[model samples]
Target chain A: DVKVTQSSRYLVKRTGEKVFLECVQDMDHENMFWYRQDPGLGLRLIYFSYDVKMKEKGDIPEGYSVSREKKERFSLILESASTNQTSMYLCAARRMMNTEAFFGQGTRLTVV
Target chain B: GIQVEQSPPDLILQEGANSTLRCNFSDSVNNLQWFHQNPWGQLINLFYIPSGTKQNGRLSATTVATERYSLLYISSSQTTDSGVYFCAGRNQAGTALIFGKGTTLSVSS
Candidate 1:
């Protein structure tokens, strides 16, 4: 079974603190993505990486950064946790093409 | 870049009922697919029909690639089927997917 695992199922952070969300895929997929889900805005991509150390900004990249130092793992970083940054974070991975992408269970982050 | 639009943003149904959800996307976005986000916030890929149709148990999906549209049908709906359904169109580059706003479905006993 293909699996995408997130480090935490829930997180609470203080405002101005740094946060890190981790994702790992066992499928050996080359493409990995980070997305945030909000009540009315739906799911919006924040960042994605196609290969190790290669990253690209998505529609909602502000206030967020990502790292892909290894093929199976991708990490999302919150430079400074803010109230507006409180949202459910999801990580996904897929092959280059012709395959279905899979997502992690998600991390529900609360910024106080 | 691609833009996806979904209709009937919200829906309510009784158990054992049937319903359909629609999604439309802009040009050059293939790999049309559907996903279900359960109340627990886990997303599962429901279908990957770039074109034609596919069925899995009580759930089925169809995508018209040329028209850039897709439809998901639910048959014999149950409480477990209550969730947000999303449709996405993958960019030609295969780098990422552009998703529709999603339709929230509520099923009652």
Candidate 2:
């Protein structure tokens, strides 16, 4: 079975603090993505990494960046946490040419 | 660019009722799938129907690639079926799946 695991299930960070959201996948998938879910905005992509050390911005990439140091790991960084940035973060992994994708449980980030 | 749209932003169904959710993709996103987001925020995969029909228990899905649309049918809904339903698919680039706004469902017992 494919598994995508996020480092924290829930996180609370002070405003202006730098936050790190980690995602790791057991499957050796080449595509990893970070998305944020809000009440009515649905899920908006933050970043996508097609391969190690390669990344691309998505629909809502402001105030956020991503790093792909290894094939199994993708990290999302909040340069400065803000209340408006508080949302549910999800990580997903998919094969390069396949359409089936799997996601992690998600990390709920709250900035105060 | 690709766009995924869903109908009935919110739905309320009584137990044993039936419902159908629709998903439409603007581009040629032949690869389509449906997911159920549980209360705990975990996305549970429901069906991956590129084209054609598939059934599982009381749930079933049909995707028409040429028409760029898909439908999910729920039969005899239960309280446990209360949750958000999402449909996603990949564009021609095979990039990550573009998701729809999702249909929020509330099933009452």
Candidate 3:
């Protein structure tokens, strides 16, 4: 089974603070993604990486950035946390193209 | 990118009843998948069907790529089977899966 693990299950941060959410996958997938899920909006991609040090902006890539320094690790960074950024963040990984992506449990972020 | 739409945004069913979930995409796709998000918010993949049909346990899924639609069937449903069902599709040349809003299933005994 593919295991995707998040560094935190729940997090609360104050406004203007920096937030870092980490994700690690045991499957060594080549593609990793970051998405924020909201009610009625579904899951909107924030950023994705096809290989180490290579990143692409998804549909909703404002105030959010990602890092993929290694094949097994991906990180989501919130430049300046705000109330609008509070939402459930999900991390997923896929082997290459057209493969079923496995997701982590998710990180519920609350910005106050 | 593909536009994926799922039918019956919300569904309510009785235990032992069966239900079918539908997903429609706007364009050609190379990959399609079905997922179940439990009450606790854990997303689990049910099927990875680009086309044709695949069955696992009491659940089965069929994706007709030519028609740009997919169907998920749950037979003899249980209370524990209630949650959100999402269908995602990747365009013919794309790698990321564009997901539908999802259908929330509620099962009562």
How big is the positional error of residue A94 in model 2, measured in Å on the Cα after superposition? 0.6
lDDT of 3 by residue, A21-98 (tens): 999999888999998999999999999899999998999999998889999999999999999999999999999886
Query: Which number leads on DockQ?
Result: 3
iRMS, all models: 1.2, 1.3, 1.1
Lowest-sum lDDT 10-residue window in model 1 chain B: B89-98
lDDT of 2: 0.92
Residue range B1-109, candidate 2, lDDT tens digits = 6889998889999999999999999988855889999998988889989899999999999998999999999999999999999999988875677899999999998
Best to worst by TM-score, what's the order? 3, 1, 2
Alpha-carbon deviation at A86 in model 1, angstroms: 0.5
RMSD of each: 1.2, 1.2, 0.8
Cα lDDT of model 1 by residue, B80-105, tens digit: 99999999878686567778899999
The model with the greater lDDT, 1 or 2, is: 2
**Candidate 2, after superposition: displacement of residue B5 in Å?**
1.4
Give a tens-digit lDDT track for model 2, residues A1-112: 5899999999999999999999999989999999999997888888999999999998899999898989999999999999999999999988765667889999999999
What is candidate 1's DockQ?
A: 0.71
Instruction: Report the CAPRI category for model 1.
Output: medium
